[model samples]
Target: MSKGISGGCKCGAVRYRGELSDISSFRCYCRDCQQLTGTGHSEMFPLVAETFQLEGPSREYQMAGGSGQPTWSSFCSTCGSPLTRRSERMEHCLYVHASSLDEPEKHKPSRILYADAAQPWDKPNLDE
Candidate 1:
């Protein structure tokens, strides 16, 4: 197993930890991610649900994915910091915002998702 990581929300109302063995990270440019983050994309790292744990007050929001599956997002109710996201369609795994990790650099996305949805001006230098 890989070393564990921990992080919490801006207001300290929510916290999470995971003993990560593996992480599949991605940068998502889907409309849902764009609007939710108010940015061109959102970075995420998926972890096995069984190895993740959380504490403190959090609120959950549910929305339909492009695939018509329900996705649930959890955040700190007090500070509105995005914490975790999961989908019934992706059973057995929970996704954590890459930036929410204590050491964000540890989770570098391997690929981009919904790249077609990316705004032209927001595109990064892929050649790098």
Candidate 2:
């Protein structure tokens, strides 16, 4: 059986619940991802947009992605926890941050994106 994902912001101001099928998860090493996540890469599961839902208010920011399409990042304004991301490049999908999920421990990225942009000191052990 597939696991369901449900979570909220650090302050419980933004809640979401969803089920992802045909899973295609990855970690992005683009500079924008690094700056937004404050880490080497941003781990996300790209799910069908229709499968995701959000409750409560969130602040959204948009910028061009590596694909040169507008990408939106939404987060809770109250606690500043990153929530969801969507890109015009993948119109049918929503990229959910693994760190925002209640079952974060279960998240396993299957691939890495923008590998050439990766930081020298931070790299995922692909062997695992």
Q: Which candidate tops lDDT?
A: 2
The prediction achieving the highest TM-score against the true structure is 2
Task: Tell me the spans in candidate 2 whose CA falls farther than 4 Å from its real position.
Answer: 1-3
lDDT of each: 0.81, 0.83
Residue-level lDDT of model 1, residues 75-121, one tens digit each, is 89989888888999887888888778888867767778898899996
Worst 10 residues of 2 by lDDT: 1-10
lDDT tens string, model 2, 7-59?
A: 77888889998777575788889899888888898989766788788998899
